[model samples]
Target: MAARIILNPTAGNGKAQKLFELIQAHLPNDVEVVRTTGPGHATELARQVADQEDLTVVSLGGDGTHHEVINGLMPEGKTIFAVLPAGTGNDFVRTLGYPKSPRAMLDVALYGAERRIDVGRVNDEYFLTVSGVGFDAEVAGWVNQHEKKGNGTWIFLRGILRHLVHFQAEQMTIHVDGAFRSEPTFLLAAGNSPYYAGGMKICPEADPGDGLFHVVWVKDLSRLGVLPLLTRVFRGTHVQHPQVKTFQTEQLTVEGPPNMLVHADGEIVGHLPVTMTVIPAAIRVRTGRS
Candidate 1:
């Protein structure tokens, strides 16, 4: 059994490096380890072993690292994936139900049950958590460019507050399954598993095994209404608001102003005019749950 740990030492503003110390003593004797040098390096590392059927590739950083790993493994990977949450937004690990403790997470990574989950594709990029556009995408781009001083949700909240006051909602055309409509949109998040921006359940009903995306769309909102609705998103109750709508689909499309930013798993992938589709049971993974 070959296993490799792809560690992103700079993730979580050095938090991953600190967490590595605790797990260092617990890794298997046979496990090989490698550290990522920069952005997209994790993907390059993971791709090196994606074709090994008997191998397990563990990601030991934040969601961004895991996002890179997933992109590397997708479409043809036979290796089992594992994650240890060591970053600001451990959203993917949250959805995986991994333990919060270092030793426990390591245990799950090394010996947990193997299962399969869905993968999401927006244009040519793949995502394991949520892919979003409009307001949230703009916020993601902003957060990526500045200093990351706080925890995941707090950081995202700060970015949201920075833009929410003056952010403008743009008109967008949406297509789900076979139906189509156009509306003023504040944001739209396509979720494979229900969580993003650390803990916000943007698409609360998304199920990775169900072969469908739980798409959440927030229609145009006034500044006052947007903030209140966003507050409820942490609890996933925002879906109940009149401005929000949820849909389940295997495929969808979003067409809007070309400048509208699009993000996959919190990392800005590109702009809008994207087609997102669910790839069912696309990758194998280790999880604490059966």
Candidate 2:
């Protein structure tokens, strides 16, 4: 079978392009490499390649690149999806137990087994990692707009601090599975996998193959109250905090401030009044041995 590599040249502050060169050398000579020029370009490339039966369409960038390719391929047909972690967060790959080296990722692309995984949908878009609203989504919007110099974790932390001073909690009415609640919330995340914001395990119990979402909601907290919990998230222990709540559901809906934005896999998608549903085993992906 052949491989179609869809690459986002600008991911990880142009580091993706450099890694692409190294990965290309390991790929077969006939493999097709398509470089994306702007937003939505990867989706188009993925759709074009997915039409070919028995081909593997590999995403060679960060989570946003993976997000677009998934949208383009679902409801999927014959193509198999694979990821090479050359993006800033690479959180989705982290959940799959892949190492963060280009050579290692490329080896998986070339030889890993195909496995089915769940996909999360918000409105009409499909996300492979996590989708949410509130403080984290707002921070994602800010980070996407402003260019930052340095590592991904430092840039996100800096953005969080900068936005925290002005970020406002929203009055939200949430419906999960069939249970409902109304509260003023600082953040709400529905995760298909456990990691986001570089390495933060926002929903530590999330599993993509289990046909459910691990949803986490943080009650309204003052800036200082939110600070200490930030470190705990990396260790997957933030759920123990009284201000945080976690549950599993096959579906969820949220009604919040109209101006509040929603983010899927770190790309700002739309505003709230959003619904997320779990599509069980919706796509096949190349993963390391379990």
lDDT of 2 by residue, 101-216 (tens): 77888878756788889999999999988999999999998877763465567778988899889988889999875788999999999999998888889999999999999999
Q: Which candidate number has the best TM-score?
A: 1
The CA lDDT at 231 in model 1 is 84
Candidate 1, residue 268: the lDDT equals 91
| Candidate RMSDs in order | 1.0, 1.4
- lDDT by residue (1-290, candidate 1, tens digit) is 47999999998888888888998998888899899999999999998889998888999888889999988888775899998788877888876777878899899998899999999999999999999999999989887876367777889889999998779999999987678999999999999999998799899999888999999999999998888888888899999998888989999999999999999988999987999999999988899998
Question: Once model 2 is optimally superposed onto the true structure by TM-score, how far is the C-alpha of residue 20 displaced, in angstroms?
Answer: 1.5
Q: Which stretches of candidate 2 lie over 4 Å from their true place?
A: none
Best by lDDT: 1
Give Cα distance to truth, residue 253, candidate 1, Å. Answer: 0.9
How close is every model to the real structure, measured as TM-score?
0.98, 0.96
